[model samples]
Target: MFQNLAPAAVDPILSVAEAFRADPRPHKLDLGVGVYRDANGNTPVMTAVRYAEQQLAQTQTSKSYVGLGGNMRFSRVVTQLILGNAEPTGWFTMQTPGASGGLRLLADLIAASRPNATVWISDPSYVNHAPIMRAAGLRVASYPYLDVASGGLRREAFFEAVAGLGQDDVLLLHGCCHNPSGVDLEIDDWQQLASMVSQQGFLPFVDLAYQGFGDGLEQDAAGLRLLADASEEMLVVYSCSKHFGLYRERTGAALVKSAGSKQVQGKLFELARRSYTMPPDHGAEVVAMIIESAELTALWHSELYAMRQRVQSTRHQLADALSTNGMEAEYLCHHKGMFSMLPLSEASIARLRDDAAIYIVAGGRINLAGLAPNKIDTLAEAIVRLAA
Candidate 1:
C-alpha cells in the first residue's frame, strides 16, 4: 500500500517560496508571500500583541487545552469585532486554528450537510481557497473577477456569473482586501451583490483575512456588514494573522448568521471537534486581552493603521514607478491591501524570476508589503526592462 502512493503536485505558492529561499542572489526580492512588512522590509510584531504576550507569559498559570471551541472570551470578542452591530441571536461561531482551518471546518460542514453544493470562488483568488474546499469533498468552481486586459476588476462579468448561480450554490467572496487581486467592490457594488443574494437563494460565504489592511477597519467591513444586513443567512471566516501580526500564532474564527436555529451551531462545534479538536490558545487569548482593554485596543488600532498606510504608500510608489516606465499601472494605486496582480504572462513571470532575480507568483500576484521602500525604483526598472 505504501509503494502504491503517487507523488502529489507541489503547491505553486509554496514552491515559489522554496525557490526564493534557495536562491543566494544578494539582490533577490520576494514578493510572493502575503505578509505585511514595514518600510524596512520586516514583519514586526505589533506593540499590543507583544505586551499581551509578555502579560500572558508572566501571569498565565496553565498550559491545558482550550476546549473544542477554544477560548469563549476570544470567540465573543472576535465575533463582536467582525459583526459590529449585527445581532448574534441568529449566529453560530467557532474558533479555528486560523482562517485556513475555519475554511476547512466550514467546508467539512458544507460537505456533510449539503454534499451537492458547488462552491464558487473568484477566477483569480487566494491560492488555497479551492484546494481546501475540494479537500473537504466539496465541488469547486470559479466566477470571473479580474480583467487581465485592463488589469482591474471584471465587475460586469462578476455580476453576470453570480446571476447564474442557483439556490443550492455557495458564493465565496473576499470580505475585503481581495487576495491575488487587491481590487475590492465598492459600497454600491456590494449593495448590488447583496440584492443578487436576496434574489437568488445562494449562500454568501465571506473570507475576511485582511480586515484592517484595506481602507480602514470599518470601511473594509462595509461589504460584509451590508451582506449581514441584507441576507437571511451567511458564512464568514475571520483571520487575525495579518492585522495582528500573529502569523505564527494561528488565530482565527468562523461565523455563521442565519435565522433561528441552534442546529448550525451544533454542527460547527461537531465539525471543529473532529478537526484539530481546538485552536491554539496564546494568540486568541492575546487578542481577547487586547480587545478587552480600551488602552491596548487603541494601540492595536494605531499599529494597524500604520501598517495599512505603509502598504498603501508602497502601492502608490510602485504605481508611480510603473507610470514613469510608460506602463498603465495607475490601477495599482487604487487597489488596497497587501497584494495586486500584474497582467504578466507565464513567460514574463519566468523571465522576472530567472533574469531579474525578482520573485513573484506565476499569475503576477505580488505582495506590496514585501517590497522595501528603497527598492521600489529597482523593482520598477526590472519590470520595465523585462515585462514592458
Candidate 2:
C-alpha cells in the first residue's frame, strides 16, 4: 500500500522559509513566514500570555479530556472576543488545534454536509486555504482580489467575480489583516459583499487569524459583525495563535452560524461529536483566563496594540523608502495589516534572493511583522533597484 507513495511539493511560503534557513549569510533577511517578530527579530511571547501560563502552572486543576467541543469557555470567550455580545443560535462550534486544524476540520464538516459544494477563495489568499479546501474533496474557485498591476485589490474585477455566485457556494473571506495582500474591504465594500451574499445565497466563511494585528480588536472585527448581521448563516474559523502569540500551542475554534430550527442544530452538534471527539485544552484555557481577568485583558490589548503599531510603522517606512526612490504610492503605506504584496514579478523575486541575499515569496508577499526599523533601508534599497 505504501509502494506508490509520491513526494509532494513543498509549501510555497515554507519553501521560502527553508531556503532562508539554509542561507549561511548573517545579513540574510526573512520576510517569508507569517509569524510576528519584534525589532530584534524574535517572536516574543506576549506579557499577558506569560502571566496566564505562570498562573496555570502553579494552580491548574485537571489534565483530563476536555469534551468534543473542547472548553465551552472557548466558545464563550472567542465568541465575545470575535463577535462581541452577539448570540449566534443554530450554530455549532468546536475548538480545534489551530486555525489550520480548524480549516481542515471545517472543510471536512462541509464535505460531510454538502460534498459537491465549490468553495471560493481569493486568487492569492493564504497559501494553505486552497489545498485544505480541495483536500476535503471540495471544488475550489478563485475570485479576483489583488491586482499585480496596481498592487492592490482589483475592485471592479472582485465585484464581477462575485456577480453570479451560486446560492450554495462557499466564499472564504479573511476577517481582518488579510494575508499575502493586505488590502481589505472597507465598510461600504463589506455592505456590498453582504448584499451579494443575501442575493446569491452562498455561505460567507470567515478566516479570522489576525484579529488584533490590524486595527484595534473591535475595529478589526467590524466587517465580521457586518457580515454576521447580514448573514442568516455563516462559518467562522477563529485563531488565537497570532493574537496570543500561542503559535505552537495550536489554539483555535470553528463556529458555524445557522438560523435553522432546533432540529438542524441538533444534527450539527452530532456531526461535531463524530469529528475529532475532543479538542486541546491548555491554550484555550489560558486564553479564557486572560480574557476573563480585567487586568490581563487590558494587558493583552496593550500588547496587541504594540504589535499593530510596529507593523504599521514598518509599512510607512517601506512606503517612504519607495517614494524616496521615485516609485508609486498607490499601494504601500495606504494598505493596512501585517502583509503587503509588492506587485513584484516572479523574476524580481528570484533576483532579490539571488543578488541581494534578500528573499521573499515568488508572488512577493512580505510579512510586515517579520521586518524591523533598521532593516527597512536595506530592503528598500533592494526594492528600488529591482522595481524602480
Candidate 3:
C-alpha cells in the first residue's frame, strides 16, 4: 500500500535536525536550523514573553476563532513595527501562521498579480526562498551575491541583475539579518537599491524575519524603512518569531505599502479575503502585551540586545580562532546575522560530516548561535583540519 508513494526529499534546512537526532556523537553541534540559541545551547524564553504568558494565563477570556487576519490590534502593532509610525503610505496587513506562511502567501499573491514574475534572489540565498517562489509559478533567477573572493555583497553584480530585469519582476531583498548567508547590503548599497528599484519600476519584496537579532531593533529595520520610504508600492513579510521569541506559536504578518491609504486598505482587505485571514492570537497577544507595557518592552529590548551582543562576540571569536588557526579569510566581521558562510569545499563538508560528526550545510551556511563557548574550540579544530 505504501509503495504507491515515492520517497520524499526532506527540506534542506530542516533536514539537519533529523540527521542530528540520529547521530550518537555526544559532542556534535547542531548549526543547521536558523533558530536563536543562547550561550547555554538553549533557546530561552524572553523575559517579556514569560511575563505576558503569566498575565494572559491568569485572565484569558475566549478561545473563539479570529476571522481572517487574526486580531485587529495585532495587525496594527505589526504595521507599526514594520512600516514605522509615520506615513501617508498605503498598506495592508494579514497575519499568517508564521513568516514562512507569509512568504508563501506573498509569492502566491505576487504570482497572481503578474504571472511568471521573475523574482531576483541572491545566488546562495536562504534555501527555502527559491522553492517558495517557484512553487507559486513564478520564475526564479540568481544575482551574484557573496563574492567568495571578499565574502561581501557583490554590489556591481547585483545591479547588473537588476539592470536586466523587467519592470514587473520582483526583487526579494532581506530587510535585515540575511538568512543562511549573512552578508547584508551596506547603507549606501541599500540607497542605491532604493533608487534603482524606484527608477526601474520592478516590484520590491522584503523578507524581514530577524529584526532585533542583528544590530538593534531599529537599526536592523533601517533598510526596510528606507525601501518603504522610496517605493510607491512594496511588499514586506514580517516575522515576530525571532524578535519576540515565539517560534512555535506562528506569528507573522504580510505587509504591502502602496501609494495611498485607500489603496493600502483595499489591498489589505483583498489579500485577507484571498488567503488565511487572521494571524494567531497567542503570539500576537504576547507581543502586544509586551510592547504596550513599558517594563516588558524594556526587558524584551535588553534580552534582544544581550542576544545580539552574544552573536557579535561569537562572530569575532570565530574569525579570531580561524585566523589563529592560520586561515586569512575575513568575512566574519562584515557579516551581520546569526549565520556565516565558511570557506569549505564539497569534499570537505562531506568528510567533516563523516569523520568529525560536524554538521553544516553543503554551502557551509552555519548558525553562529549554535557555537557555544566550549564547542568553539572543537569546531575550530574541525574547520582547521578540514581546511588544511
Candidate 4:
C-alpha cells in the first residue's frame, strides 16, 4: 500500500515557509505565510488572551469534552460579534477546529445536501479553498476576481459570472479581507451580489478569517450581514485565528442560516461527529471569557485596532518606498488586511528569492504584516530592480 502511493505535491505556501526557514541569510525577508507579525517581527499573543488564560487556569475545573458543537457560549458570542444586531432566528452555529475545519465541515454539508452543486470561488482564492471543496465531493470552479496588473477586482467579469449562477450553485466569497490578493469587495459590490443571489437563487457561502484585520469588526462583517439579510439560506465559516490571535489553538465556527434550522443543526452535528467529533475547547473557552467580560472585551478590541493600524501603516510605508525607488505601487495602500499581490512575473518572483533572499509565495503575494518597518526599503528596491 505504501509502495503504491505517489509522491506528495509540495504546498505552495508552506513550501516557501520551509525554504525560508532553511536559508541561512540573516537579512532574509519572509512574506510567504499569512500569519500576522508586529513591527518587532513577532506574532504576540494579545493581552486579553493572556488574561483569559490566567483566569481559566485558576478557576476552571474540567477538561471534559465540549461535544460536537463545542462551546455554545463561544458560538453565541462570536455569532453576535459577526452579525451585530441582525435577526438571528434562522441561524445555527457550531464550533470547528479553525476556519479550515469550518470550511471542510460546510463543504461536507453542501455535498450532503446538494451533491451536484458547483462551488464557485474567485479565480485566485485562498490556496486551499478549491482542494477542500473538491475533497468533499463538490465540484469546484472559479470566477474572474483580481485584475493583477491594477490590483483591483475584475468588476465586469465578476458580475458577469455571478449573473449566471443559479439554484445549483454555491458562491464562496471572502467576507472581508481576501486572502492572497487582499482586494476586498466593496459594500456596493456586496449589495449587488445580495440582489443577484436573491434573484438567481445561488447560495452565498462566506469565509471570514480576518474579520478585524480589514476594517473594524462590525465594518468588516457588513457585506456578510447584507447577504444574510437577502438570502434565506446561507453558509459561513469564521476564524478566531486572526482577530483573537488564536492561531495555534484552532478556534472557529461554521454557521448556517436556513428556515430549517433544526435540520441544518442536526446535519452539522452528524458531519462533525464523523470527523473531529469535538473541537478543542481551550481556545474557545478563552474567547468566551474575553467576550463575556466587559473589561477583557474592551482590551481585545483595542489590541485588535492597534494591529490593524500597524498593517495599514506598513502598507503605506511600502507604497511610499516603492514610489521612491521609481516604481508606482499606490495600489498597496488600497489593498486591505495583511496581503497584496505585486504584479511580478514568475521569473521576477524567483529572482526575488534567489538574488535578494526575499521569500514571497507563488503568485507574487506579499504579507504586509510580516515585513519589519526597516526592511520596507529593501523590499521595494528588490522589487524595482527585478521588474526593471
- Give the winner by TM-score: 4
Candidate 1: where are CA atoms >4 Å away?
85-87
The residue-level lDDT of candidate 4 at 146 comes to 96
Give lDDT tens digits, candidate 3, residues 1-388: 7888988767877787788889999877888887888889999888889999999999998988886767667778778777677743467777788888888888877876688688988878888889889988899988888877678878887888877766778889888888767888878888887888778898889999988878887888888788788888888888898878899999988887765656555555566566666667899888878878889989988988898899989998888888888776567887887888887887887778888888888788889977787787678878888856
* Deviation from native of the Cα of residue 330 in model 1, angstroms: 0.6
Instruction: Quote each prediction's TM-score.
Output: 0.97, 0.95, 0.94, 0.99
Tens-digit lDDT string for candidate 4 (282-324): 9999999999999999999999999999999999999999999
Candidate 1 lDDT: 0.89
Candidate 4, 314: how far from true, in Å? 0.5
Q: On a 0 to 100 scale, what is the lDDT of residue 59 in model 4?
A: 100
> 227 in model 2: Cα distance from truth in Å?
1.3
Model 3 has how many clashing residue pairs?
6
- Model 2, span 1-388: residue lDDT tens: 9888899978898889899999998899999888999999999989999999999999987798877678888778898888887675666676887988889877876887789898999988998999999988999999999877777778898889888787658989999878888988888888898888887888899999989887789988998888888888888999988989999989999887876545444554565567556677989999999999999999998999989899998898888887787776557676777888887788888888988878798788898899988999888888879754
Q: How many backbone clashes does candidate 4 have?
A: 0
Ranking by lDDT: 4, 1, 2, 3
Candidate 3, residue 134: CA error in Å? 1.4
Lowest-sum lDDT 10-residue window in model 3: 260-269
Residue 204 displacement (Å), model 2: 0.8
Candidate 2 global TM-score: 0.95
lDDT (C-alpha) at residue 236 in model 4: 95
